[model samples]
Target: MLTLNQIKNNPEELIKKLSVRNKDFSQLIHDAIKTDNKRKEIQSSLDATLEQSNKIAKSIGQLFKEGKQAEAGKAKSEAAELKEKAKELTAKLNDAKAELQTILFEIPNIPHPSVPAGKTDADNAEIRAGGTIPKLSKKVPHWELADTYDLIDFELGNKITGAGFPVYKGKGAKLQRALIAFFLDEADKAGFTEIMPPLVINEASGFGTGQLPDKEGQMYQVTEDKLFLIPTAEVPVTNLYRDVILKEDDFPIKMTAYSSCFRREAGSYGKDVRGLNRLHQFDKVEIVQIQHPDKSYETLDEMVAYVESLVQKLELPYRIVRLCGGDLGFTSALTYDFEVYSAGQDKWLEVSSVSNFETFQANRLKLRFKKVGEKQTQPAHTLNGSALALPRIVAALLENNYTEEGIKIPEVLQKFTNFDLIN
Candidate 1:
């Protein structure tokens, strides 16, 4: 949520920047300003009326004390009328403020100046790519390799729960666990405190993370309990600082968590749901940061580099792309997506996304920090990234590392998996 002052002071400039994200603001901005102006007018009127009423009441009391009964009665009548006017104006002020807030919530954050104006992922700029694509002796899709090795049971998972929820067996399950631990370990080494947040969150938590009002359909809602299954550890981990006011020393709070993410993947149909491409439930290790506004962009770059290192250590062929305006997430001002090469599919599969949300979420969450030696509270910048998501990474690994004998595990993960190969 943008501050009314920001909108009022530079409406045109802000709207122009937001246009890069294809947001139209002519009407919404104007309406919000009008509502805010009305609210101020009503408040001023109410304040003046209340002040006059208080003065009249004071005069009435003095008159009564001085034995001027008639004068006191007249003053009392005037005060009553002033009080009634104040009440009416107060109601109008409340309504106007509510209208203003509604409009403000509808407006999105302005895109960062560096964001490219484009319509789709195809228009995204490739900033950097790392590692090398492996040469394959035989093309084998991840799902086929999983079956040949009896590692993952998709059919049984479908009968037990539903599609998009495969059951990992033997080496498959071990590899998944290894990835989670490896990612978390890397994040910890990078100054992120490891956290284990709740998998279920309330409505307020969802809105705090900017998941409600727009992506509600993409979450699993527990209607009876009024809770929603977390779509990512980001929701709960980032919400940890919601409504908090911290000292300057707490400017950049880094945290990471490993959680089983749940999503409805609604409207996704056909073969796109095949194998590990899309899933209703999957594991991910997430990294979140609450930083001072000035240092947020730097933190974002560092996070991207960190995730890139992890991907490179796994020896997976991957590339980093800067998301174009239209392809950016709603809460993020800037984003970089990491896509790993899948040999069998002969395409890049998105395995993680690192984004800088700036103060967009902090405003909604009321997450603030007191400036050094100052009494004012300022919103902190919030950022989150998937250190890595397991499903697609698993898919990429299986397809890219498949051999005639078995699938060779990455050297970094050998210690964690207790084996050099999954045969």
Candidate 2:
């Protein structure tokens, strides 16, 4: 929800930037401007009618005081007509504003200048890569390792829920807990205040994070309660500051939360949908930050560095890629995806995505920060990233660390997992 002022100031520039997403935004921009104009006109009519009606009421009082009952009655009738017109104008104004908002809702955020002009993930530019690709003699995939070592059960998950819901057993469940704890501890060490957000959120919470109306189909909804299962901890954690005004000193506000994320992931299939690769329910540790606009990009770099460090600590071979326009998330201006080399799958699996949504999500959330001596509050830049998501990270760890004895746990996670191997 871009502000009216933003749209009025060179909206064409915004539309042109969206060309990288490969869509035409001309008609949407036109409809928004037209609807705004109609709203302004209706608002003017309402104001004029209200003013005229007030004047007539004053005239009616004067006429009555001067012993002219017929004249007062005429004034009252005129006031009634004006009141009806004002009501009609008010309704029109509401309708017009609604129309304008509907159009705005359909428009995605404009990409940052650095966003590469591309159509898919394959077009994304690689930033940097780290660690050595393991040369394992056994080319066993993660699912096979899961079965051989009693880590996860897909059939039991299918029996209880359906496909795409995996049941982690024994050390498998312990590994999930360990990764969540490890990620949380790492984020907490990085000056992020930990928060435990709700698993179910209302429509406003979803929309505040740009998950509603657009991604409604990809979420599990509780129809009776009118709540949606949070697709990520990002939704609830970020929405906590919705409609809040922060002081200038709160520039680098950092918070982290670990939550069980749920996603419908409707219509996804193929070789990519196997095991922990894609899931209806998964665990994740999310980091969110609200920063001053002037320093947001710097903060984004710090977040990316922090996630990179975590991946390094896990001793996983990883690469960083700047998401191209088409592959970018709807609300993010820029995003860097961290993918771990899964030797088992013989491919890189995305374990984290760090993004900077400068003013785009803030406008929707009404989140603003007031300058020390300024009267007006300005929208602050919002940022978030998966310090690490468990499923794929778990997949990569198991696959890359496989040994004849058992799946060897990384030394960093051994303390958390309470054992070195998952046999």
Q: Which candidate is the best by lDDT?
A: 2
Candidate lDDT (C-alpha), each? 0.91, 0.92
lDDT tens digits by residue: candidate 2, 155-260: 9999999998899999999999999889999988999999999999999998899998788999999999999999999999999999999999987999999999
Segments in model 1 whose C-alpha atoms lie over 4 Å from true places: 50-83
In order of appearance, the predictions have TM-scores of 0.93, 0.96
Worst 10 residues of 1 by lDDT: 17-26
Off by over 4 Å in 2: 55-72
lDDT of 1 by residue, 92-169 (tens): 988998888778878887788888999899989899998899899998999999999988999999999999889999
Worst 10 residues of 2 by lDDT: 1-10
